[model samples]
Target: MELPVGGHPADKYQNPKTMKTRVIILLAIFLSAFALLPDRVIKGTVTDGSHTPIAGVNVSIQGGGSGTVTDRAGRFAIRVPNLARALVFKKTGYKSLTMPVTSDSVLNVALTQATLKTEELADQILDHSKQPGQAEKSLAFNRVAAAPATFSGAVMQMQVPTESYKPINENGFLSVGQQPVTTFSVDVDRAAYSNVRRFLNSGQMPPEDAVRIEEMINYFDYNYPQPAGEHPLAITTETTDSPWNPGLKLVHIGLQAKTVSTENLPASNLVFLIDVSGSMSDPNKLPLLKQAFKLLVDQLRAEDKISLVAYAGSAGLVLPPTAGSEKKVIKDALDKLEAGGSTAGGEGIELAYGLAKKHFLPKGNNRVILATDGDFNVGISNESELQKLIEEKRKAGIFLSVMGFGMGNYKDSHVETLADKGNGNYAYIDNIQEARKEFVQEFGGTLFTIAKDVKIQIEFNPAHVQAYRLIGYENRALRNDEFNDDQKDAGDMGSGHTVTAIYEIVPKGVQTSYIGTTEALKYQQNHVRATGDSDEMMTVKVRYKKPDSEKSILFDLPVKAATLAFEKCSENLRFASAVAEFGLLLRGSEYKGKATYADVIQRARAAFGKDEEGYRSEFVQLVKTAQSLDGSQETARK
Candidate 1:
């Protein structure tokens, strides 16, 4: 052992107290010197050798776990201990680089591409195929596995929408003899269509929950005969051979709300509840929201009124209840908006509802149009709380319409809950074209409610059908007992909007693993269909309340079991079926029997009647895009 720093070896032996004091002084001096060293932040951009931003690159201090991945912009900032000797940058498909930490804080790194091992390539393929919870171990491996991709030297990190979706449990075959009735709300919201489009356009399969077949089918216009009766909607049914599965029959139900002329529509009272959070700063978010709202503004009549409520870390009334006549003023207020601060969605909701109540308009089109990416971070951020808030406020007679924008960190579940509870409709705007479709082309259907608490119940006859399954609507299913309960809430139907629902039925004696049979009842006898009763396959019952009423009106339609050849079905039904098949394929659903892109394209093309709007053609193109992504060559169009 060496003598204490401040004393000689003889001093320690002669005087222990002097030696101890010298040691304490020396320790203090050493610590003070170390404390004086500068704490530094290393900030820089990571790129490929080609000088393009490389997102998702991992940057770390050597010998430490402290690290961060580059943002979508390929920028990163990390705090390093003063003693850190070097910084390391790494990513897949690129050479890992470690450099000494010099006096400079900014270190721009350009990584070279490198060849990956066979194991690495297999791991990447496996990672892509594994579902969220199923790949925990694989994901853990991937974190430490620095492999190369076939992609270019620099890959821009795409903004991933962290939208939550509950996996859809496809309706199971129910024994008509035991349980004949199936009931669900009539959902007209078209959010799923655009949401699915967003994923496919980005070259990814959509989350299963995002592919609601009914919504995708309803997203397009269907030519159904208008209602001439006292009812506000016309109910039509078409039965045909299942195009995807030869073993089953497809039942299509269509509901078309009565169209009211724009001039005849009621005066409007609107509240634009806009989110201006830091998350909305993306070009596709706040800026796009402004553009969309401007379109709605242009559609407003002189009799209409508008209110603007903006929220960030807090909520504020930006423009209070301005008349539609002052379009310039409303547009100016929207143009001046900027995105910053954390999201306070709950606060914003409360304030928006407060404003709507303060300027309550009876017998007018009173509604609140909420524009957001659904990032409710600051207050009442969870689904249940937001649902309760909307549920309570909906009783105030102001309907809500939710428009979701942007991608990253989107709270889809919260928005869905809010719309469902608030007597509203939800639509996701992925691009300006979708915005135009919602705000301009389908303005009335997007904003004006024609019927509330719309419910559909189907009672299948045991003699005609053995088992049946209602396609999609997993999240919208309601108890059979709740169908007639006027107090029970269901979905709303907007003016001129069309809703479609399909049921796959296994006729009596047909075999299917989708549903199982129960033993004969010992307690009760199965009812035998009398003479002509066997011809009726099912009875469809619809219950709906007028927009402002509490009592619901009931209507029934008897569907004959007669099955049409797939080729003989109406063009509308064929197209809708094609869309449903595509949705199933995207979801990777177990129920997607024989639903090939080729089949869907063929059916859609054949049914692409009167394509003046070019929507059907666009759909064909989208299907091709999805096919290419799925690694299939496009078959020649007939």
Candidate 2:
């Protein structure tokens, strides 16, 4: 190098060898700056063995010095140096794949989803595990609540990945004299229970709103008697001292829909409206959904007809009307679904409903089964808009069932609303077992509706009950007059389905601050045939319409005021109360009273009758896990 400059930094190097070293340092610095400017850009989509795009995948150059995450559509763009030799793609619960860099600018790669060994999964779920995080992420899913503040409170909610839940205000006691009539639509959705299990199993407490006490209690089966006559359902009631509050009385009301065997079921005209948006790339979402549909396919008979429609950037029909016997066609259509683009849920609904109408099945089950995380963003994604579309479809005699999958951006409020408006049911699938339960074991109850617009109205006798508070069903409450309105839409009861509701009542003479005294209500007793001297506590009235009927029928049952000790109550009451107590603890309700996780666990285990499929037993285990995570002690009222 020629040193001819004036007083300058580089001019200070006079020795030839030193000058060479200086030149080398300058070259290194120049290369470092150049490294920041990549020489090439590579783009590709990551997918699973089924050729479905995999979202949230980690894409990086070999050795991981630089990386980018795949977007909602499983597509990623990375800038790399010309010398970069290979790309590494990895995701949790999937076999990592590394591919050599080629001259091609676009390279699409597929990964093989790996199944963790049973030992590994079991070790993670059991109490005292060292890696609860790993098990939850690989199995169900792992999501932490959004932080409350940025760079401050535990969770910066606005900045973190978050799940959605409609906030709940716990129901409080109402004086029987002031408000004796309680009316509500029966809810059959079990999403809240499994979703709660997802949270507790991941070594974290579920957010309060996620705990719907009624859903938790209804998740298990109760031995309510089947209808003994021409009616489609039977109603039963029992009262016992509360497990959480001995001073209070727990009233259990159950309605069981008669079971219809598969052979006797009507033909179904099904429309599968799937959300193949990038957000659905999780293994638990799309892959698991495909598997669940296969189970439904396996149960299909010759009379059933099915259609498939999917939405991403836009909506389109993937499969036209085809007989359920053509399994390969449906499975192939499902297999080729690759998640990408924005969600056009509204468009998807319109198209699916159109198809359902085109192949209308009179006297058959016509339903649009919507599977999505409910992260609608593209067009008409608002809850009210979607509800409007479903409402319009409802008029056409098309029902909709919503299947919620995955988390972290899940629109739970939207899912529930769509199902409610469509006059159908909803379920959240956190794992394959739940999928099996929804699509296989409860096949009839999941798809075939036996009764619709089912509503319950109960009138408490002021003489026997001073005050009463209904547990859960806050969202399902209706105006007292809506009970007998045939035009009003309520809830649908599927074949072999059961619904339960609990009430905490304060007896007339015994009271310990549950419901503060009210003077006017005391003097104004419900005097219209109140049965002042009778043993009747409350009268249960049910109104419902046949699945395809336009009119409603009414029936009533009178429940006795006799109360049993918690120990003497039937297994149904004990187990359901245990679940309710657990919900109170999870929700931290003001009315939790003397509730404790320890009591819930003990009560649940004692009432774990037969547990043929081990669901109740699984519930006990989950309670144990929750107790461990909650740091609950053996004592009551933790």
Candidate 3:
């Protein structure tokens, strides 16, 4: 018989050498299959270059059906098909990475941090034109993120109400009174320092009356740490001059609110304060609110309890406090709610608080979740009385969370105040996804309070800096004394919440100061503390009271490094800065420089981070809408 070279029946009858070759061939096949099986076991660790584990990173194989998120340790394991040649990794705040599978079944991958660039910021500002029915006089900005920096930047456009656009004061500050919306576009360069010092020293800008766009932007996203543990909160601030105008510079800051595990959250007591008034008869109003509530109902745990209250001319208990485990009962109550009569929001709130108080679970999550258009037309309609009632109820330890719905008559002012006074948070539910964000995705943080009365006080070293101004938080600004006052209630931060603020600084050696010294301050003798070290820029102090407590905790951090180059900041910080500038322009802020929509877009484009969700891209579209509205208004005026 002929000798076989590889595994064959003939090899049995062949010589010893042929038989040995046949055995080797069979062994090779078995080893290959074993090797393939090990590759099928996909494994990797999601981490930053700094060797820090990044949880919640999503991992999936290209063209494969299954995916998994990184665990608390930033480790992930998935069973992929043996045939798969590669896999992809992604996360919201981190860049997405795709890798080819190698012989080692175990893989260690480091994901680069996601950031926005200058051009990306610009693109976002220009893209805002796509918003529906954007008026010709609308104001808009572009937000972009950059690498290594934590915040984003914005480019803005101002639509001048009249042809004669001039600052009322010779100083940089714009007068608060009404001015014709002017169409002016300038790039707001990123600022290297914080603006808080400017506000404190100048006192030219009115407190409480002015609205900082950054605060409005940061307020809705409640990402405080969980009650169980400390969460890492990061913030970056930057400022640069307008690409179109050297005289103007924009300031931007980015904040990242880290989330803790939900394993230790306490059971919740949620009271639904629904508004089923005559105005809510539209399908999108009452019906949408009903649907939204149902979605929230689905997110509840078995240990959680819920109650229902409806208001129109009067308020009534639609459902008593019931266990979340009983879904059908809650759903039935929600289904039966009907809309009629004039809005009696005050009465509704009183009744809702009564129910919440009755069902209060000490040391547990107790909150009245109010859903309404914020229109109150019946008895006790005064905002002061309503504020007083909510403030008093807050003392009872029952928190308030407001969900704003509908337009045309939306009471942003009232809703904002109620949330602030009630030691809770507010959200605007324009769509189902937003509802999910507030109710489903961030359920624990939305309901529970890890920290309350959170406040930040940064004392800049006058030796290293000449002038500074806080970018936003115009309404939240506090006097140096307010920081120590436990009775003075500040902003309430929920679980896994992160708050960020920024300031623009004019270094001592800079040619000119954006903020001039006040007459009174100039006349007064100044005391200066000189530090020889140029590295120490400022000292940051953060103070907060634990939820349900009166005592405050304080933390101090020193900013020792000199100002970072404009290009060095991360994309997120750059993009966020653009957004701040745009917001300032929209509010007609006194500090707004030569910021414009086109400049905002260009900066956003350069710093556009890994925008998997397209939020940054959508912001660009909004800017375009604002620009079109501004142009049309100017033409009509002509």
Estimate TM-scores for all models.
0.75, 0.76, 0.64
Q: Give one digit per residue, the lDDT tens place, for model 2 in 185-287.
A: 9999999998887665443557777888888887888899999987898998889887777778899999999999999999999999999987788656777
Positional deviation of 131 in candidate 3, in angstroms? 23
Let me know the TM-score candidate 3 reaches against the reference structure.
0.64
Weakest lDDT window of 10 consecutive positions for candidate 3: 183-192
Q: What is the lDDT of residue 410 in candidate 3?
A: 49
Writing each residue's lDDT as its tens digit, candidate 1 over 1-638 gives: 57776755655366878878989999999978987787779899987766766655678889985666664356788888777889898765577899899889898888887655545545544654353212322222211122222322222222232556666787777887678789999898888888876665444446666678888888889988888899999999999988888779999999999998887888888999999987788666887798889998999999898999999999999998888889999999999999888889889988998888888888888788899988788987877887877887777788889999866466677788789898999999876667888989998888888999999999888778888888888899999999989989899988898989989898888887777768765543536435235688999999999988899999999999898888998888999999989988877777788899899999999998997656676677567657754542112111
Clashing residue pairs, backbone N/CA/C < 3 A, model 1: 93-148, 93-149
Q: What Cα-based lDDT does every candidate model obtain?
A: 0.79, 0.80, 0.60
Sort order, TM-score high to low? 2, 1, 3
**C-alpha lDDT of candidate 3 relative to the true structure:** 0.60
Candidate 2: residue 625 Cα off by (Å): 2.0
Candidate achieving higher lDDT, 1 or 3: 1
User: Which residues of candidate 2, in runs, are more than 4 Å off?
Assistant: 1-160, 521-530, 632-638
Compared with the true structure, model 1 gives a TM-score of: 0.75
